[model samples]
Target chain A: MDALTGAWQWLTTAANWAGDKGVWHRLAEHVQISAVCLVLSCLIALPVALWLGHIGKGGALAVNLSNIGRAVPTFAVLVLLTLGPLGSQGEWPTVIALVLFAIPPLLTNAYLGIREADRDAVEAARGMGMSGPQLLLRVELPLAYPLLMTGLRSAAVQIVATATLAAMAGGGGLGRVITAGFGNYDTAQVVAGAVLVAALALAVEGVMVAVDRLCDPMRGRRRAARIGRGPGERRGARDDDAVAIGGAA
Target chain B: MSVPWSLTAAAWPSGQVPADPGGPWLPQAAAPGGADCLVANDWICGAYLRTRSHELLAATVQHLGITAASVALGLLIAFPLALLARRRRAVAGAVLGLTTVLYTIPSLAMFALLTPVFGVSVAVVITGLVLYSLTILVRNILAGLDAVPAEVREAARGMGYGPARMLFGVELPLALPAVVAGIRIATVSTVAMTTIGSVVGFGGLGNLIASGLQGFFKAEVLTASVLCVLLAVAADLLLMAVQRMLTPWTRPRAGSRSGGRRTRATKAVA
Candidate 1:
């Protein structure tokens, strides 16, 4: 009973604190870190992904490297880099770490999207006397844009969420408030920080979803429907088609 | 070509001895060697080993345990939810969207939020980790399940198989590849994110890195970072092996084009 009361008081206090100017500063810092990390990662990853997709070479290596990046915990990487000769113990290390963390999705999607562009369409463009660069820019890029965008969306969300780890290294963000709360045994602060993060993430995701809809209006309806139908229903439907096709083939 | 005497001397008159003192004549510092070097190396190594093992062990166990538990919980929740969601498209979409939103919440913030409520316990850590995994698991499981053939389901139904039997006997086996792919992704993610749990004093590999940063212990930090990369690679390989073993049917058989054709068909359907 006492513990519950204590938790309730803490929650109320933290909620009040959240409305203060400091909390807004922390939120701004968090958003800035996330944005910088996302943009930097996309810039680095997108070109490489496009090049790899165009050449159809080094994709396996790039993908595996990205996977390795995904596997290595960002927090560990931040700590390691910060302690190294880089001496980057602030937002920079956090940004670098998040950039590394964000690369795989962007790279994978861009590579896959371009590589998997309709070959027939490329052939048709070639028949029309399109040059290599022309074909890529005119045909391949447009087709790959949607997938690339998807990767960026995922990266954005991931960076926003992971940016909090920056706080643990004595950097500033909503994480700072949460950590302070934890240290002070203030449950309300912790809850408030978390709620803010959750709200922030959802808002970001909503924006991305809206962006996805605007960018690929044709896919908007189908995409939601498809994503909603558990992979099984889709698979079952596909397998049936496969068996039929296999028999025919 | 009347050059100044200082310039000529400094430039070294062709084929003549230069008055300049700067040449190979400047002796480089001798590299440290023998017992002094060995003793320094030993001291460094000793210092590292002494200060490192406790942090390393604590971090490793915490990471491995939390990741394992989170992935397991995620799978437990995701599989059934996926199954249920498959039947109801609206419900499945909502669940997936919810989880996706949950997944986007930054880990640090989530931990911060959870800390107050759960107070830095293993429960808080696992809950956060599991929530992260839910989105990926649900998506993958659904994808895997969707990969199953309708005919197979119909045939099973024709043979009087119930929904449970059809799922287990036909849909699951066929969808194993996609489902396993999802698991592989979830596992990799869980392993990486488990480090975030360290913020709550759960003591994972992230702790090692954190301490290294605070104390300026480069060796410890490097050791921890390398271990994490290696762990992720090892886990990926392990899961790949497991996926292969579990779904022998998906494997391309020797001297058969059936697998290729099936793959194309699956792609078309997808």
Candidate 2:
């Protein structure tokens, strides 16, 4: 209780919100790094994943390859980049490490989503004389939207969490607050920094969920019913579960 | 070259370098062994490994132990929660929601939140890891149970099997693959996450990685990171073997690619 009070007091302190090292500055830095990494990751991964998924060739290999990438701890990647030649570059090491860390989920989920899009619908669209790009954009992308959003949500949250390591490498971020607290043995400040990070992560997750709902192409199309009945729906649910499991890790 | 050199110097000023210039923290300084790669900060110095074998072994063991214990405890806890959720649909949403929220919490923040309660100890690390594993384990177990064919359960019930026997003998056997899949993911992710534990001085290989990073000890960082990755892969493969042995009936046909696909999909995450 006292610790909570202390943390609250630390959070409310006016001085803590001022200067270059203050809470607001660190929060902005954390959000900026996370957004940049998320965008870069999506740009780098989604096209390749979607393309391979559309071609229906080499996607499994790509997915499997990315799965192996997941086993490499993000912390290790960040530290390795920092110690290597890139360590001297301003924020490049952090950006590159985070982008690498965020790629696997985006790649795997997007590829799986595209591959798992309603095949019969795709066939019908093709039968109606739709071109390759037309079939993909009109039929596949909408169907794949839910899983793509799942991947984005997972990646976004992960980048926000992992960006704290920036402080460890002498970069600016909310993690700096925690590290500084540790240096000073100020438990209150450490707790306060942690609270801010947790709040930011949750906020990111909430925003992603909102975006997923708002941007779903299948909106107002009785998606619930489509997701409820038929053999196709059952398989879709199972695949979504598998993808959720992927994101959970 | 000059650009990078100046940046490096700016990052580390003179006062930060301790009197013993060649100490673990100052990788570029002159050392007791003037000609050694360890003093020169090579990424794979055999001498460092040869000298620090015991320390390396200890960290590896600690890492392995923490992972095993966390997953095991998580399984024990998740089983009851999964069973409860399966039996009573009312609380299912709450259970899943709580775990998912817990999963989203950054690991560093997770540790900080628990520190007040568990203090600076391995228990704090273990508890956080156990919570993290719940989202995977509970969902997989539930999915595995749900995947059991309805007729199979009906047949078991017709054969005088009670709920307990049906669960233990019939349903669980059928659910083994998914359960094992969950365990594999949890184990591998746990191995990766265990490195984060180093922030609190309890991370197995993480401690070495952290210390190595501070000192810019290339060999230690690279070696520990590689070992951590290897450990994750090895654990995953071992569990895959276990899953296969436990479910021989589900083995893929000679030319079928389904088995490979399922494995890859289940291992979608770390």
Candidate 3:
């Protein structure tokens, strides 16, 4: 309880929120780094994942290869980069490391999203004289939207949490706050930093979920008879669950 | 040219702790002989092989111990929750929701949160790692239970098996593959997460990387990180082998190749 109170005090203290090293400054740095990594990872991963999912060739192999990304520790990558060629290049090393870390879930979820689209609906769209691009942009992409958002949310949260490694590597982020706390043996500061990170993650999750809910027209169907869900939402929450398990890890 | 981190770390002023140096807070500085051999770039691999072989090997064992113990503890917690969720539909929602929320809590934050209560020890590390393993385990466990064909349960009942006996004798074996997959992901992930435990002083191979970073010992950092990746792959493969051994029936007998491999693979994760 004292620890909680102390953490609250540390968080509320105006002095801690001022200056170049303030909590708000650290939070901005954290968000900026995370945004850079998230955009890069999506650009590199999503198109390939979506295309592969569209053509439906080499998918298992592609997913398997991507799984290797999850196995390698991102922190190790940061350390190696910092200790090696990019040691003095500032935040590039951290950015590269985090982009790699964010790739697996983004790629996996996007691929799974498109691939899991209702084959019947896709076939129906094709039969309706829809062209290839039309089928994808019109039919498949909307179906894949919620899942893509979920994947994005998961990746965002992870990158935000991990961008703290930037601080350890002499870059900037909220992790700097905690690591700084550790160096000073300031438990209250460490707890406050953690609270900040946790709150940020949950906030990201909540916003993504809201976006997903709003975009997904199938939201109110659960009570509308199982039949409504069958044709509309193909394996809704369950697909997200599998993504969370397989990709988020 | 890429100068080793030591030069930069040494150049930093002492008062700036973050920039001053980087490494494990708990582990002592490397021995003089070990540090000397690793001072140059070319001799790094040799230094690791000669001096760090034992330390790296010991850290690997400790890493495996911590991961295995955490996963096992995860299983103990997940089973009852899964069982409860299976019996009561209402409880499943709450239980799964709680575990899912717990899963999203990042490892570093988790360590910091638990530090106030548990401090920097194996207890804190394992506890956080176990929470990570829960959603995977519980979901897979439920999915496994849900998958036992309805007719199979009917047949078990016909054979005079009670619900408990039916679960133990009939359902569990069939559920083994999914359960094992959950365990594999959990264990492999825990190995990676254990590296973060170093921040709080309980890191296994992570300590090597940490201390190596502070000392600018390339061999130490590279070896430890490689060992971590290797450990993850090895743990994953080992579980694959165990799954193969346990589910001998899954292997294709002759020419039924198409669905056999893919279904099992998907089912494990699905």
Please estimate how well model 2 matches the true structure, expressed as its whole-model Cα lDDT.
0.79
Candidate 1 at residue B38, lDDT?
27
Show where candidate 3 strays beyond 4 Å: A217-226, A229-234, A245-249, B1-37, B42-44, B255-270
DockQ of each: 0.37, 0.61, 0.53
- Looking at candidate 1, what is the lDDT of residue B23? 35
Candidate 2 residues lying further than 4 Å off, grouped into runs, are A222-228, A231-236, A239-249, B1-35, B253-270
Tens-place lDDT digits, model 1, residues B51-147: 3454455456656777777899889999889988989999986997687557667777766656645655667778888887877778778877875
| True-structure RMSD for candidate 2 | 8.0
Q: Model 2: how far is B217 from its true place, Å?
A: 0.8
lDDT of each: 0.66, 0.79, 0.74
Q: Candidate 3 clashing pairs? A: B22-B214
The positional error of residue A114 in candidate 2, measured at the CA in angstroms, is 1.1
Model 2 Cα displacement at B45 (Å)?
A: 1.1
Better of 1 and 3 by lDDT: 3
Over A104-223, each residue of candidate 3 has an lDDT whose tens digit, in order, gives 777777887888887998999999999988888898887776667767877776787678766665678888888888778788998998898778777767876787778775567534
Q: Over the stretch B1-270, how does candidate 2's per-residue lDDT look in tens digits? A: 122222332333321322232335435434446439877889888767655655567678878878888899999999999999998877788898898889888888888777777666677788999999998899899989988767667766777878888888877877888899889888888999888877666778887788788878898889899999999999999999988887765676574665544443233211
